[model samples]
Target: MRVNKWGVGVILAASVLLTGCAGGSDKPADEKPSGAAQEENAAPESDCPELKDGATIDGAALSECVTEAMADSAGFAAKMTTLGMESTSRYNPAEAAVATDTTFGSVVVIGEDAWVKSATGEWQAADTASTDPTVVALSTAAKAVDASDPMGVAGTLSGEYTVTGTGTRLGQDVFLLTGVTEEGGTSVDMVFELTSDYVVLAATGSTELEGQKIESVQEITEWDVEQDIIAPL
Candidate 1:
């Protein structure tokens, strides 16, 4: 199948930003803003913010933690469910397909989640592992890692601005990131957020698709991260 180059490009860009530029620099020539560095050099997380000991993550390590957490499909699934992406599991392929069609902008999950297809093509699971990489990666990419000590991710990561905004879902502090990027010859808007502990709480990416900028938002509540106590993402 032909690739939605713009779709993949935007997703990749979001991933790099959320990973705190940890993946290193290497952009395909097809990428835009020629000569623009793909990686942003951020100071070690030790410079970000701080939370109480054993209750928080170091800023530098926070990025790594989020990268790992976002890679966990179960965690992301939980968040997606909160965002109303339920029934798209390995058990119910049909519901998953319908759900994806209603929400996702560029792609959606179909089948028992054993397989996923977007405008680009199909993605078969490499193993029976329940974790969904796409969900985790997208969720993680939306969060903003702290810049100081205990660099937990908490907030959004947008192109023009990133910050810890207000709002709470499932009882976790919500942050916001917003900005714009050009795609398919049009300017698109993006917004995503992280929990206080650095988990992606929710995210929404909107672009002109089907003649309108469709918005999809995911809210992850029911956090069990802190011994069942109320804590930040």
Candidate 2:
């Protein structure tokens, strides 16, 4: 099986933003948001839920937690690393930082248009007329990490999972969950880290791909804050 490195990044990045798909009406170059309009369009503060430490989580409860987090969150910034390549993304409802890395360079999406960053760091138009698979994947995965959402961090699992422990991460309290899946006699171990408010902070897992071992991690460092994810052009 041929593995598209970019697709792997997209799958991990999707963990952060799994609520909606990306696509919108095209905006003329002249219609891009400016000073005041940009400020006016900024995301609002998230009303994160109040969850105590040592709380238990199952698949259904996990889904509800993710729903609440995504609904309250304005947007988020995420880093996903797989096999040694890393892609960082920032997303709000209106704009997305897109997939960016040293290997595949970068792509930015705003409304219905997408742009690719050149080797010289110049931005150029990408095919957004129909639907570019990469762009669509980037779009749907650009929302915010909702741990309970199947489209989010738990996309790889098949059976049930349980929250096993609580601990501190970067001075913040977090809940830990683990799940195991078997495929072709290989066992994949998945672990998740969630905040006291039920927001997913990170997820790490290991599995074999085409007889090669691959480990992946996805982390959400910032959310519900003002992020300047503007069009590169």
Compare the candidates by lDDT and give the number of the best one. Answer: 2
Candidate 2 lDDT tens digits, 139-179: 33333222223125433334656667876553456678777
TM-score of each candidate structure, all chains considered together: 0.37, 0.59
**Candidate 2 least-lDDT 10 residues:** 1-10
lDDT of 1: 0.32
List model 1 lDDT by residue over 73-100, tens digit each.
2222222221123211111111322112
List runs of model 2 lying over 4 Å from the truth. Answer: 1-57, 94-101, 118-121, 128-151, 154-158, 181-188
TM-score of predicted model 1? 0.37
Model 2 gets an lDDT of: 0.49
Worst 10 residues of 1 by lDDT: 224-233
Q: Candidate 1 deviates by what RMSD?
A: 16.7
The RMSD of every model to the true structure, in order and in angstroms, is 16.7, 10.9
RMSD of candidate 2 to true structure, Å? 10.9
